[model samples]
Target: MTFNIHQDYSEDTGIRHSKYSETSGEDFYHDKLNEIFYGCYTRNEVLELVLDGGDDGYTPSFLDESIGNLVYDFTLDVVKTMLHIVSDWEPYWIDEIEKKTYPKWEERRRKGEQATITKSHGAWYRLINGVPEKRVWIVYTEEQ
Candidate 1:
């Protein structure tokens, strides 16, 4: 079954316009795709469209960007849940989430750093779906 985020859930058109339609950053999806990204995990179609509203699918770079944001808004586990919910609770979404997006979330979630990112880099970053992010050497410099 082909999925159309805009047409399928017209009830949320207002949200599709304001929240999901923004293009500036991640975490923008923020729990919406809890019912949004099933297509990417199961069927085949637009990943970002459901969030950022467009008519495109799976460009290497776009896929990369969308994955990061999707993990941020909905953890790999949650994305899996969303997909399964659409699949009548089937578990195949597990394979897709595990292969495509889970490792990054797992490594960070275990380390317990999502809170750090939320506090320190919250303005610049879109926090890690309540999980830790890849650790990095953050250096803030001041010049005279």
Candidate 2:
């Protein structure tokens, strides 16, 4: 059975986020995948759910990050092959990645002060000292 992540994206479940549910869009996306990874839905169903989210339509950010992490178990070639099936839905060109990488936490990584932002594999993570050793958020960087 497929799960409807957003029964109503417009309605706030009181999850509390900087802008919306504290669970960044990417993390929420992962939660859905967990269902797939565990056999709740086949990979194809996962792709279908992604292809159909929101008014602007789900952005690549929503799928790319989660899909990239899939390499932890599935191969880069396998993920690419899956993406190829729904090529039209992707916003950008996603080619084969030689290595699959997950966002990691950095310390004193901001403005010379260490601003670290990384994405985590699952929902809810622990912070190491104040910076998460795991990726939970996406970080924007300035030139060195």
- For lDDT, the strongest prediction is 1
Residue-by-residue lDDT tens digits, candidate 2, 27-79 = 54345553354342242433333233334434334444444444333433333
Residue 135: error of model 2 in Å?
Answer: 16
Each candidate: what lDDT? 0.37, 0.35
What TM-score does candidate 2 reach? 0.37
Poorest 10 consecutive residues by lDDT, candidate 2: 102-111
lDDT of 1 by residue, 32-97 (tens): 342345435444443433322334322222223334455544455654444332223324433454
Candidate 2: lDDT over CA atoms?
0.35
Q: What stretches of model 1 exceed 4 Å from their correct place?
A: 1-3, 6-28, 34-54, 59-79, 85-97, 115-144
Give the per-residue Cα lDDT of candidate 1 at 73: 43
* TM of each candidate vs. truth: 0.33, 0.37
Candidate 2 residues lying further than 4 Å off, grouped into runs, are 1-25, 40-50, 57-59, 81-144
